[model samples]
Every structure is written in structure tokens, then in C-alpha cells.
Target chain A: MKKSLEGRVAIVTGGGGGIGGEVSKWLAKEGAAVVVNDVGSDLSGGGFSSTPADGIVSEIIGSGGDAVANYDSVAQPDGAKRIVNAAMSMFGRLDIVCHAAGIVRDRMVFNMLEEEWDDVINVHLYGALNIVAEAVPIMKSQSYGRIILFSSVSALGNLGQCNYSAAKGGQIGIVQGLADELKVDNITINAVFPGADTRMTEGMSSTARAYIEQWGVSAESSDAQGIRSSVRNAPKVAYLCTEAAANITGQVIGVFGPPMTVYSQRVLMRKLYKSNAWQFDDLDFAIGSSLNRNIPESRLGGKYEQR
Target chain B: MGDRFRGKVALVTGEDHDLIKEISTLFASEGAAIVANCSHSEWVERMVSEINAVDGVAKVGHFDLTSMADAESLLNFTVDSFGKVDVFVSGIEIRDGGSVLDSVPEKWDEIIRPVMKNVFATTKYVSAHMRTQNSGQIVNIIRDKKIHHDISVTNSIITEAIIGFTRTTALDMEKYGVGCNAVISDHARNAALVSAYICSNLVTPGISSIFRVDEQEVSLYSVPAIERGIYSSDIFSVDELNYLVPKYLFDGEELS
Candidate 1:
């Protein structure tokens, strides 16, 4: 295939390893000047180091691709601005942004602390906005940009991940609103919900792991078999960051081993009985009818299984 | 001759009698197994039987755009018959004619209930199977203009809603390789239904001027029997729609 992103400038947050590292490499290999921004924090979104980011930057430079490392946390507005500035200062312009920096605080709603929610939201949702606000003005000046935000299947409402879900869900809303505002400016914004073997989900509860394993799936750490699956699911993130997706905006696509499904949050089938005035009995009937209409053997319920 | 979708199952809906029939027959000729054909009227049944008689695989299914249950069943029947749904085409028109004040609530619902709502229902359900298989294409036939000059404001609103829904779903499902796009057709074929209230009446002098008709004298000097004006055809050809639909879906690539 032709180099889809030749001469493009990309900024990938959390570019040390996992999805961010792979995305950073892919963009560089496709001829992009990639700015690898990572604070080297763990999956919970804390800590800092230049090792991981710098290592990836060296790897790209060694391979004759343009890249630089920036140790900046995406959680703060100033940190986000500095990352964008690094991209412009190093590459001269920014054309693509893959906001893959995020953290997971796995706690059920009852046990979820306020700090847990705030931290997750700060790094994923607000961090996304901070970066976008700084990047969009430059993109608007150029009149060409592609933004790939990371959402999760968890946003479909995962258990023991209320904070993560809230942050990821908020990312979807932000993408939709921003896409509408930027459509006339020739900028397209989209999100990818990837299913791959990453450091984040490696420690799933035995019960959940068992269920996934029973489906003939193993943890992505399982030798070559697991690595192959991870690679297959990873390219989609790169594809979304390419120029061919110009007409596509405000979308959330799921990327698994081989299957890629377009998930939709749609209005359920509604039932309205003919009436100008309503009563308790009418309310009961309407609720019952709405439930029945909504709950058929449809994909909405299938794609999102309730725990 | 090159049947990329050969041995695959395809489903089509709506009421472009000539266009749907032709497209369905073409897919069958290209080796696709026509799983189910649905329409809002009985006339579609007659067309289905004609395709079946020619040994082009097909089954008739009830489809009323107003009913989501029927829309769901249309998809279920396709999976039940062929065990998979490889392609889906929606070619229905559900908009009623009238200006803002003249258009009633019931009429607005009549138009939107099928075209917009039904398409949403189908995309939501059919995509479930495609996602599992990691492959599928959905083509929705939309009009070039949201309002056809004479229709009410509701038409534009409904059209916008569907387009928004399509864009959102397209992004969400890219990982599964499922593609979604709408084909925008021109206005000639459906003009009679929208002429009076939407477009100015094709006859009245100033009203004719609104549609850019030239001035003509009606007097004793005029001939007793004279042709008034020419009628324009706004309906797009099947070839044009087919080409455009895939272009939108694959981002200008011929490959599905």
C-alpha cells in the first residue's frame, strides 16, 4: 500500500508503549514526523520519566523517520500546550493527533472515590480537550487536520470501571460536538474503541478472564499467538489517522482481532398512544410498550452485554 | 462478471420499483444470493416474484417503514435464510409534501417514520452480524437536497438526523470493517408529489416564474391547443446511484 501519511506531522500522547507506542511507530513509518509524548506513568496515570518516550524517539530517528520525545502529562492544559508546541517546534506543522493517553481506576460506583473519578476524567476527557483546544487553532489555520481520540468498549458501560467509563464516554460526546464545529473547516474527528492485548487490561479479575478464555481467547501476553492478535487490531488506529478518512467524522469504530464493528447509540423504538392528556395508567402502558419495543433480539443489547 | 459479492447474501428495501428491481436482478446475475426483498407496498411482492421466477434467489418480507418491528424482522429473515447478511441497500422515500404551516404532524411523521427511522433500525441490527463477521456494506438512498423546494421544514430536519446518525455509526464501526454511506439522488422522479406546495405550481404565471419558467401570453391570439411547457426528470439512474454509493462507502475506492 502507498504511504498514507507521507509528510504528515503526528503527535501521539502516552507514546511509551502499548497502543500509543505502536501508533507512534506506525505514523512514523508512514512518513510522519511523530512527536512521542509520554510521562511514563503506569496504567493508573501517575509517575514520570523520559526513558520510554526517548527510546521510541531514538528508534524512529534511527530508522530515518523524523520524531522527538516530550515527557509531558496530558492531564493539565499547560502540559497539553507544551506537547503541541514540541510537535510544531520539531516538525514545523501538525497534521494528525492521536490522543491515546488514558488511565483506568477500576472501582464499582459504590466503591469509586471522588479522586478516582477526577483523575481518570482529568487524564482522558479533559486532557483530550486541552490538547484539542491548542491544536485546533493551528489546524484551522492550515484547514486540514485529523484527530483520532480513544474511547473504549468500556464506555458501553463496563462494571468495576465507572470512572474509566465516564471518562471514555465523555470522550465520545466531545468528539461528536467538536466534529460538528470543525466540519466546515476540513477537519474530521473520530474515536477508536480497540480490543487488543495491552498492559491496561492484563490484570482482569479471574472470573472475567475465565469467561474470555472460554471463548478461545487468551491474554495478549501469550507468546506469538497473542502478539499476532494485537498487531491485527492495532493497524485500525493508524488507518483512522490517515487522510483517506476525510469524509468520515463523529464516528466510533471497534477494532478487534479481525472483526471491526461500527457501534451506534441510537434512539430506541418508541411507542406513543394517541392522547392529548395522560394519566398514571397511560404512563404505565407507555413505559411497558417502550420497554417491549426497545428489547427485541436486536444488536444494541447483543453488542453491549449487561453484567 | 467479477462477482466480488458472489456466494454472499444481500438484502434491499424500499419502493423504487424500477431501480430496486434492476439492482436486485444485477446482484443475482453477478452470483449473489438474494436473501430477502422488502417494500412498503404489495407492488413490491409482484416484483419479487418476477425475480424468483427467473431463478434469482429471493423471498418476500413485510416492510412498513412506520413499524420498527417489521424493519427488525426484515433483517432477521435475511439471517435466518442465508445465515449471513453481506450487503444492505435502503431505497425508500417516506417524506410527505407541504410547506411549514400547511404540513401537519401526522404527515411529517408519515414521511420520517419510514425513511429515517427504518434505516436506523436496520443499520443497528444488521451491523450486529456484520461486526461478528468483520465485514459488510450498507447503502442508504438519500435525496440530494433535504427539502425539495415545496416540502415542509420537517423534511430537512429528518434528513439531517439520518445523516448525523450515519456519520456517527460509520466511525464507530470502522474497526469491524463495516462501511456505511448514503447515496444522494436528484429530484425529478418525486416532483409530482412535491410540486404544488413546495415548488411553485408549474402553471400559475408568477408561480411559474418562481420555477424559472418563461413568460407566455394567454389571449385570443393564442392557439386553441398549445403545449404549455416541458417537464424535467430529476430521478437518477441505477448506474449513477450504484457508482455513487460505493464511492461514498469506500472513500472513492471501487473495492468494498
Candidate 2:
């Protein structure tokens, strides 16, 4: 029996550890020649080591999968091009590019340093652009490609993660806006909000941990040995890179747990219709009484719920 | 002059010449001391002169919002010029548009650097002041002109970032009696009016919502939420998911 991706070639950025590593291994196991690219940067995207990429490549090859290691940072355009070039040089073709590279510098919006903001944006948002900029042209020329950006649930907005949320949120915009242009060329791009416990989550503050707990879904790290492991997210991510997923483009999918989640794009929830411009008193009354009925009154303002 | 903002001070920042002019003049007319900011000083100086000519107290801030020192200085100038800043309106216009495939790393820097640096730095400094003062209104207005057939990948990306920043900032500053919200106007139509309303006392604090302003109507954007889900005893195969996802999740119909 021929494997689904027997002749395919894949480039998995940040494939050294965690969810990205698992996805690289899964793709290789399914018969795709893999280029496992990792800068081996720390959680905040500083420092680099070739050991992480080399180790993952060895693991894949030992498991009877064809693989090579590429230690190029995706934060720069030149680095991104070299990553794509590695696939073409060794494997001769590129079919799948999964960008799971990311970093974090969590801070309250007020106290966030300029460097902190720049570093996070450079890694997550600019890194995505660098990879996609190089890979898309190749994919477009070949008339076949599958690209997946590892977005986060934080894109919706998380406390103390303004930079991260903004970067992740921008990824959503890329997938949404680019879906139309890429689909015609047979290249599909989507964002996966992988919910996994990893090094990223291990450093969660007590407040952040409590917030996650309040949501009733405890995150399990990809390295954990269990059915609830973050490794479970790998299969879904890998599946998106398969030829079978050609129909899916410009979609935001979440891989967290018992159920995979599908999110909708920005849509109008409610409206205040008017022919003439809104007067303060009238607009205030309409929004307060009707639009804000469901919102719980906060310490700042809004109508308190009548118990 | 109207007494709506008789004793208040407002700072306005953006690249759109007309929108900034309209907003600055409107706030000044409402009796608020104005700080009109831009990268270039000449136009802003002229706007400030016109406001002062009309007996409206106004100042010009030509510093870069992307710089921390400049951001702090801008805020300091506002305090030193007027007593303090009570309202902030950010009308930064996003002009980048192209397909993701056609975009480059430099384009990303060009488009994102200004928006992120300006918005984040300005909000950081301004919110620090507002937090101490125990009262302020911060409204970020994003303007984009959607070109038909252009993918607008960078534009959409920056827009979402701003929106997300607004919500996160709102949470951080809410307890301090500071309100943060975002207004997304595709055409810059009626942005000044809507922004003024957001700064008004009628708007409730701790309410961080995105409003899409158009020529005539204003619509509230729903927070992006999971509209559907597919649960299986185990993760389904590509074949199973390829069939079930659309039927159950994307079709806008209930699953059995």
C-alpha cells in the first residue's frame, strides 16, 4: 500500500522539540522526506544550538524515516530561504511547510519593554512572513503546497500577552486574507491553534494557571506520556499537510482535546442602525439597554444584573 | 464652545491627514485642550495654529510614536502643556496590501513596525499616566481601504493585532478606571464622530469591544469563538475528517 505522503517533502520549522518535533516525526513516518529545521532558541527566542535539530533527525532516521537537519532561524528572510533551499537541495522538492516556530515575552501592556515587544513580534509574526515569503513562490510554481501556521488561543486575547496575542492574531489575518489568492493555485494554508502543554506553558504564572484551570481544560504537555499528551495534536497537524487536506484553506482550526474546534472569522454580532448620526444620549441608551444585556457588569461600568 | 470636555485634555495620533484634522478640531471645539501628533511637524503645527486662532488651546507633537523616549516625551509634553491627558484617540492608517505569497520580510517590517511600535509604546506611556490618574478613555481607530482583489494579508494581520492589543490593554487598565476600545473603519467614514462617542462618559469601562464604523451605521464585532466542534473517541483519520468537518462544522447545520 502506498503511503499518503510517500513522495512528499516537508520542512518543519521549530521541529526540534514539543509539538513541532512530533509533527516532523509524524510526517516522516508517513513516508515524507523531512527537513527538520530548528534554531534551538530558548523560550524567548535567544541563543541557538544545532543539537536539537540533529537529535530529531537521528530519531526520525532511526525509526526508518528519511530526514535531515537544518539549523536556520526563521526570524530572518535569508535564514528562511536557506531552510527552503535545504529541502530542494536534499529532497529535490518541497510540498509541505509547517511553521511552528514561536517565542514569548509575557508582560502587562503598561510595563512591557520596547525590546520585549520587538523580540516577540519578530519571532512569531515576522518569522511567519519570512517562511511563507520564501515557500509560497516555490509552492505556487509547483502548483501544490500545504502550509500550516501554529497560531495560539491567545490570539483571542490573554492577560499579560499583548505582544504574543497581537502576533498570533496577525497570523489569523494572513490565513484569512491569503486563502483566496492561494486556493486558485492549488496551495492550501491554514492556522492551527494547538493546545498542548509544553515548555511554553510550564512557566505559566499562578494567575495564568488559575485562568486555564477556570476554563476547565487542563493542558497536557506534548512531552507528557499519556493519551492527553500534546503529541496528540501532532496527528491533526500532520494530517493537514497531507494531499487529502487540499480542500481546506484559509481556515482556523484548533487542536486541543476530546474534540477539535473550528472557529469563525470576524463577523458582525449586533448593530445599531441609524440614518442620521448617533447622538450621545440615544446611542448610550440603546447600547446599554439592549447590546449590553448579556455582558456581566464589571467593576468599571455597565448595568448590574438584576438577581 | 461646547462644555462637553471643558476641563479635559485629548491627544490624537495617526497618519491620515484629514481624519487627524477632523478629530483634533472636533475635540478642541468641544472645549478640550488638544495635542495633535504626526511624524511631520509642519502640518500639525498648522493645525495647532488654526485651533489656537479660534481660541482653542492646542499643541503640536511631531515625535515618532515608535520610539519609547518619544512616546514618553509626547505624554510628558501633554502633561506639561495642559494639566493632564484625559482622552487618547489613535487613528493610525494601515496602507499595506498584497498576497502573503508576494509579501517580503521587509514589507512585514514596514507595515507592522509602525503600527505595533506606535500603538504599543503610546498606549504603554499613556496608560501609565491614566492608571495613576484613576480615569481615562483610550480608543484605537484602525483605518484600512480594502482594494478589491488584493489579498490584504498584511493589512488584516495588523488590524487583528490592534484589536487584540485593545482587549488586552482594556483588561490591564480596567481596574484603574481606564477604558480601552478599538474602532475599525474601512473607509475612515465617520471615524471622528464614533471616536468622540467612545471617549464620552456614556461609554462603560471594562468593556473592550470592537466596533466597525461605516458611513451610516455602527456594528459590534463578535469575539472570534468556536462556532462548531467535532468529537471522536479517537482522533479521526484524514478521510473521516475530510468528510465530517464540512458536513458537521462548516455547513452551518446542526450535527446529529
Candidate 3:
């Protein structure tokens, strides 16, 4: 409604349903020519039909907005390039990119399979890379662009989600690296570690579900339909992708029900002793002493950490 | 350029020759009247003259950061001249010696007074002025790395103090629609003292090299070093700051 993004072109991967779909609709409503790239995969990253993408595109068009549909897997290089190309061909230029495509394979490291790791990694991390690799050149040429990558709280080392953590953590690292590198090019890159319910959470165990529910969301209500009907939390993931966030780069920000918080993952807390030779005993003593005196987590705890 | 900040006024304080010059010049070029202060009058005069030659409006104010009265005067003069204080950039860093046991009390006060206290006093006065107008942006430039020999204890304390001050001011001022944020940078090329420290004491056979002259050296510190140097222009360009400052001050709303 603000129209701050008028005349812009955006590509939202995993746009067939859930948060991605909402983000796509929001972008289109703001006057962006949106390309809803959905492969119609389930929570575990299996394929379905392209109907979901088609459905969202229809909804946008029916609401008197501009949108197109692309049924491509963000897991591959060619698929990623195709999504960017779709935006360029349909809308003529790309201004914003929201890489929200991901899958959840919850497993403890002891029982995690190689394919499980690869599947989540391929969808979230590589999918992000695929699109970014293709989009950066176009962004550089235009001298203006916004890239928003998705990280999750699980990246902070959640139980039974080693693979998910690895992928999400990698995404944060990529966001920071890209943000620092591309700021000079006028392309701002940032990561959002959102705490919202979606199709991804419905698959978690009941214990995990109960823990997340305390944060004010039900697992069942995160379905694609539930999100469309506004049954989820406030300040949806779409808010972070808007043009008003242009100045925030290389930051890991969290949003939950009207409370927006900026986190400091990269912090220099204590100055430990490091001499010409770092013996094991000396290193241990230095670390212990530093930890005892100053809690690194407590420095910026109130704003970021769970109360 | 456009008169985006035509009616706006800004103040920057520091002795880092390159940073002070670049920030003042950029603000002036964007139609914001600049009041730049340094310890030395010659540096201030030089910057003012250069800005004038480029058709930008700027005036030099010579003041030491150690004085609270001078800091208050800088804010008062800008508001008195331009009718409002819209932006503030703190670029002062005074590094002296201090460690846990060997640090002298005098040195501690000297180092903390200029870098951290100056910012606190300046923010106190400016936020008071901006609370009336209900809009302002404060960008505090901070060194991400601590340069201390035996002075590691005090260095960490001072660095953390600045960040705490910035965050506290941000939250307190948010109600009045004022925003304060810190820009963290690794050792900058223009910081002559930092450069000397890295070159002299840190250069050794086994010690991991801490500083790199080339832009690519940023990769060594973190994964994201796309280029070298820590100047405002290299880290965040004028256009980017223009976009960010307004966004932070207005909280994602469109600024007129």
C-alpha cells in the first residue's frame, strides 16, 4: 500500500505457499512485478505440481496487481539462473530478490542421513547461491538492488536439526560476506532469522511444537491456507523485504508479533591473552578466566536473547 | 546533486584527516550545511575551503573533544545557524596507554574522555534538541578491533562502553523519533596510529598478520571483505548512508 517499491521487479523463490507466497503477494501489491518461483515441494523437499505457483499468480492478477509464475527448483544452478531470467524477461529489470526457498529435514546428527543433509543444504544454501550468483551481475549493472536471504533460529544450534542448523548458519555467513562485499556496489544484502510458523514447522515433533507454540503460534495454523487467512503472527516475513529496510545490510534481524530486534552474532567481547606461543594450558586458562569475568552472551543479552 | 538535505544541518568531530574530510564533503554536496570541528584550526579551515570551492556550504569550528562546553557549542551553533540539527557523525578516537595493573588513572581518563565521553555529551545535547523536532540521525563510527598492548583491559571496556551508549541512546530516543546507530569498521587506512601499531609490533614471523594494506585483506578478518580500506566511502557510500540514515530515523516509513 505504501508504494515505496513501485516500478520495481522482485523474485521470491518458494513462492507457491506459506511465507513465500505471502511475500510474493505483498511485493506485487506494492507495485513490484513479482515472479513467484515455486517448485511445489513438500516440507521434506519432494516435488509436486506447479499448481501452487499458478494459484498465487492468479490471486495477484485478480487483485489488480502484476505477477508471473515460474515452476523451477532453486536447488540447481540452471534453475536459479532461470528464475532471475524470468524476472528480467517478464518485468524487464530486477530490483529486489527474496530467497525464501527452503526445506526442513529434522534429525539429530547421530541419526542424520547424507541425503537429508544434502537435501536441506541444496534447497536453502545452494538455492540461495544459485539465485545470488545470477542476480549479482544484474544488480551491479543497475547500481541498485536488495537481496534478502533467510536464516532461522535453528542456526543457533537447535536440537535434532544439525543439518538445518548447518544450512541456516551457512546462509548467515553468506549474508554477512555478501553484505560487506556488495555495499560499495549499491546492492545491500541482509539476512532475516524469522520466527514465524509455516509449513516447515508443522513437521516438527510435538515437544518441539509445544516449545514453539509458547512463542505464540500453533503448528497446525502455519499451513499454506492458514497464512493466506492471516492466522499467523504479526509483521510477517514480507515486512523485512520491503524498500524501507534499504540501509540495513549484513545484519541478522528477528521479527515476532510486532517486536523487531537486531542481533549481534559478530561481537568482540573479551580480550584474551595471546602471546608468541599459545600453549594448551595457557589457552584454557585464558579462556576460562575471560568467561568467568565477562559473560559474552550477557553483553547484548536483553535485546536479542530469549527472556 | 538533489537538495534532499537542503534544510538539514550536520556536525562531525574527529582528527582522522580522510574520514573528517570525506564525511563533511559528502554531507555538504548533498545540500546539508556542515559544521566540522577538529583539534587543529588549520585542518578545519582546509576542509571548509575545499567544500566552498566545490560550491558546498560548510564552516570550520576548532574545538578539542576533551571539552564538553565545546561539544555543546558545536551543536548550538549548527542549530542556531540552520534552525535544526538533523545529523551528527562522531569520528573521534584518542588512544593512550593503559593496562589492568600498569594503566595510570590519568591516561584512563584521557582516553575515555575524548572518544566515549565526547560522544555521550554530544548525543545528550543533540537528542535534547532533536526531541523537539521529533526527527534526527546519529552515526557513531567505532573501531571493530581493539588496539591495545598491555592495555587490553581498558580497550575492551572503552569499546563496549561506546556500543552500550549507542544502543541505549537509540532506544531512549526512539520514542521521540530519533535514531542512533554505530558503524563498525576494522582498522582504517586513514588511522595513522593504528597503521603504525600493526606495522611495528604486530609484524613478526609467527604472529598472524592483523592488518593488510590492500582491500582484499578484509577477507582475512571476516569472510566479507570485498575490498580494502575502512573510510566511510569504502564501507558505506554517500548514497547508501542517505538511504540508511533516513530509514533508521523514520523506522521503515518513507521520509519526505
Candidate 4:
């Protein structure tokens, strides 16, 4: 593959470990000046350090690639500006922003405290906004940029993740909204739902993890090509932060274990209408005879316990 | 409709054919004391009279749900009569009919406000009531087919926004023995009947989805032509509505 992003200045907000770390390394190997950012957050959004980010920066530099470590948090506006500044000050330009910064605070929605919701949304959704806001003006001035936001299948109203789901769902709106606003400026923004295991995901969705553990399976059960196959998609994720992907914008791509698919957003399935505004009683009866009475049995909601 | 809801109280909106004659009547037949609420329409008195004739308990009311005062009044009426609203089936209004760019502020406000604010106000007041008993279901009825005929841009936005709203509210109310979900009416009629029962019978751990009432389910009941769905496309005609209403609702019922 070509070093398509060569000479491009890029920032990977959670570049310290797992998905973000690999993405940062790949971007650097492809010849971009990488700013590997991480606040070294423990899984629950507490406890931070600069070591993880520094370590990734070291790996990139050691491999003869240009890189630097940024320890600022992306969850705050000022922290986001500082992260962007790290790229311009170090590499003299800003081009790619791979927003991989996130935190996990899983609980049944009812069990979640206010702070839990705030912390998770702050990192995943608001953090995405802060960095994009700091970068968009510069990207517009230079007339070129690529933005990639994180989303997941859980965004379809998964249990025990109301805060995470809502924030991720909101990201879809931002990707669509920003893609339109920046289309004329040659800046492309898209959301990627990566289906891979990382440090942060190690203990989440415990029921599934317990099942996998029972089978003695982990993220790298069958490593090959001198790197974990599950993480091989890091290169594909890096590709979105390159000029080669300029035409792909305002879309949600599902990057599963191997085969990737583009998702259709908010499609209309069917319709029942009237020439005049609907009256309350007439609508109820019409809905029963039409919309409700028509659909097949198994395709409806609440098939299994929603919680 | 089943006797499972015989002693329950159901508050349904829309006074026309589907919301009243079908969904609401179906509920009353099964024993739910009905609160057939509607905006002042010429057809409401007749709808209520038919319900009373069948020995089904029902009370009719006129309130523009967009206004908080009106929504509260409607809720108050239900409380005064039935002692509590076990199920609140909300019917949305759709007015804007133009391209997104052509839609002015008033048009957007007019079309979107009533649909969403009704949800906010009704759920707010009803949720307070359900909290006292620690049990209830909020079924938001959305117009799935309205824009299918005329590229109703504003309606599309409002509907999609409500889905987002429903998911968040589901999260908020699940703790209080209250479950929130939505049903997509292929049209405005029979809108509340099926969904109201679906909402009233929503078991613990409700399925959160947009149930599109298909042609097959419509054929099971003897609804008029206007009460059935027609379209620019038959994309989901083959797909079942179980993703919203669940399979139990259609058990032993014809899907053809």
C-alpha cells in the first residue's frame, strides 16, 4: 500500500493503546507527522497519566517515523485546543483528526448516576465536538482536512448504555451535519463503528465477555502476519484520515471483524395518508386497520427482554 | 385485545377511525376503561356513543395537546374519571407540507412543535402520575407514511427526532416502572388502537423499536380502504412489524 498520508499532520486523540494506538502507529508509518494523544485514562474515566501516549510516540519515533505525545484530555474545550496546537506547533500544520477518545461506564440505565452520564458523554460526544471545532476553522482556511468520529452498533439502543448510546447516536448527527458544512472546503467527516477489542472494551458487556472467556477466546486468539489479525483493520481506519478518502463523507461505515459495510440512515419503509389533517379517533382506527394490522409477526420490537 | 387489560385504564388520542373506532374500540372490547381524547372534531361524539353502546366505558375530551395547559387538563380528566392512566397512547400532528428549504420558521414551528411538545407535556404529566403508582407505559404514535406521498421534509425530521427522544425517555422512565416506546402508523387512522394495547400490555423490559403496521396485519381486521396503507413504494410490505409490537401481539393472528 502507498504511504498515502505522507507529510500530512494527524492527531489520534486516544492514541495510547488498543485501537487508537494502532491507528496512530499506522498513520505515522504511512509518513504522517502523528500526534499520539492520550490522558492515560483508566476504564472508568478516572486516573490519568502521560506514559501511554509517550510510549506510542516512542514506538513511532523508534521506527523512524515522525511523532509526538500529547497528554491533554479531549473532553474539554481548552484541552482540545491544546491538542490541536500540539500538531501545528510540532509539525507546522493540521490535516487529519481521528477522534478515538472515549470512556466506558456501563450500567443499566436506571442504575446510572448523573456523573456517569456526564463523564461518558463528555468524552465521546462533547470531546468529538471540541476537537472538531478547534480543527474546522484551520481546515477551512487551508481548504483540506479529514475527520473520523467513533460510533458503535450499540448505538441502536443497547441495554446498560443509555449515556454511551445517546452520545454515539448524537455523533451520527454531527457526522452528517459537519459533512454538509465542510463539503465545499474539501474536508470530509465520517463516523466509523469498529468491531474490535481494545483495552477499554476488555471488561465491558460482561455477559458476552464471560461467554468468550469460558471458551478461552480473546481479541487475539489467532494472531498472524506478525500482528493481531483483529487489529489489522487499523490500516483501514487510518485510510479514512487520508486524501484517498476525500469523496466519502456524511456516511456511517461498519468496520466489522473483516468485511466492511456502509449503513443506510433513517430510511422510510411504508406510508398511510389522508388529504386532510388527521382527527384523533379516526387516526387510531386507521392505524389499527392499516399500519398495525399489516406487519408480519416476528419483525416487531421487544422480542427479547429489552433490559 | 385481551382481558389482561380488563381492569386497566387507557388514554388514547385521535378521534377518527383508526385511533378510535379500531384501536380504542378493540381495547374497550377487551375490558380497558377508555379515555378517548381528541381535538374538537365532528366525529368524536359519534365515536364515544358507539363505545358506550357496546357497554365499554369511555369518556371523550377536546384539548389541543401542544399546549401544556390542555395536556394537563386532558390528564386531569382521565385521573378524575378512571383514577389513573395505565397507558397513554399519544397521536402526533403533521401540518408542514413542503421541501426543507421552502419551510419557513412558522411552518417548521407549527408542524414540529405540536408533535414533539405534546410528547414532552403528556409524558411529563403522565410520568408524574405513573411515578405515584410506579407503573405505566407511554406509546408515542408517529406518522410513518405522511411524507411518503409528498416528501414531507419537516415531518421526517420531527419523526426521526422523536425516535431519539423516545430512546432517551425510555431510559429515564424504565426505573419508575414506566416503559416508553413508539409505533409508526402507516396513516392517521387506527393509529392508537394497536399501539395503545401494545403499550398497555408492554411487559417489563420493553422492546424499543419503530413498529411499522404492514398490509398483512391490516388485512387481519376489517378496516375500511382509507384505514389501510398505500404508498409510493412497497419496501417493507414483506417485513413484519414485530420489531416494534413484538410477536406475542400477533400470536394466532393472520399475517397474510
Q: Per-residue alpha-carbon lDDT of model 4 for A1-307, expressed as tens digits?
A: 4467777999999888878887898888878999999999897889999999999999999999999999999988789999999999989889999998888887654345556766876788668767887888888889999998877645545456666766676566567645656778999988876645666566556323322232233443563322323354466566667675666687676543433345555443345655555444444566555554534321232222111
Best by lDDT: 2
- Could you list the chain B TM-scores for each candidate? 0.64, 0.90, 0.68, 0.76
Flag regions of model 3 displaced more than 4 Å: A203-244, A274-276, A292-306, B1-256
Ranking by lDDT: 2, 4, 3, 1
Query: Candidate 3 on A39-148: residue-level lDDT in tens?
Result: 99777888677998999999999999999999988887788878999999988899888888888877533234557756876787667767887888898899888888
| Model 3: CAPRI class | incorrect
lDDT of 1 by residue, A138-162 (tens): 9989999999888765554344654
True contacts kept of 2: 0.65
TM-score of each: 0.53, 0.91, 0.52, 0.63
Query: Model 1 chain A: which ten-residue window has the lowest total lDDT?
Result: A298-307
- Candidate 2 residues A1-307, lDDT tens each? 7777899999999998988898898888879999999999899888989998999899999999999999998988899999999999998899999999888999988899998998988878888888888888888889999999999867766678888888898888778778877888899989988766678876654333332332334543442335445666777777788887777788888776546667776656677777876655555677667654564332112222221
- B1-256 in candidate 2: lDDT tens per residue? 5777889999999888888987898888889999999876888888889999999999999888888999999999999999799999998788765655665556667777788899999999999999889999999988853422354777778887787788778767868989888887764546777777778854555567777777767777766656677766565565666677667766744311
The CAPRI quality class of candidate 1 comes to incorrect
The sequence of per-residue lDDT tens digits that candidate 1 reaches over residues B67-111 is 546656877888898889877766545454433224433453455
Candidate 2, residue B70: how far the Cα is off, in Å: 1.0
Higher-ranked by DockQ: 1 or 2: 2
Runs with alpha carbons beyond 4 Å of true place in candidate 2:
A205-216, A219-228, A295-307, B145-151, B187-189, B202-206, B233-240, B252-256
Of candidate 1 chain B, the 10-residue stretch with the lowest lDDT total is B217-226
lDDT of each: 0.58, 0.79, 0.59, 0.64
lDDT value, residue A260 of candidate 1: 40
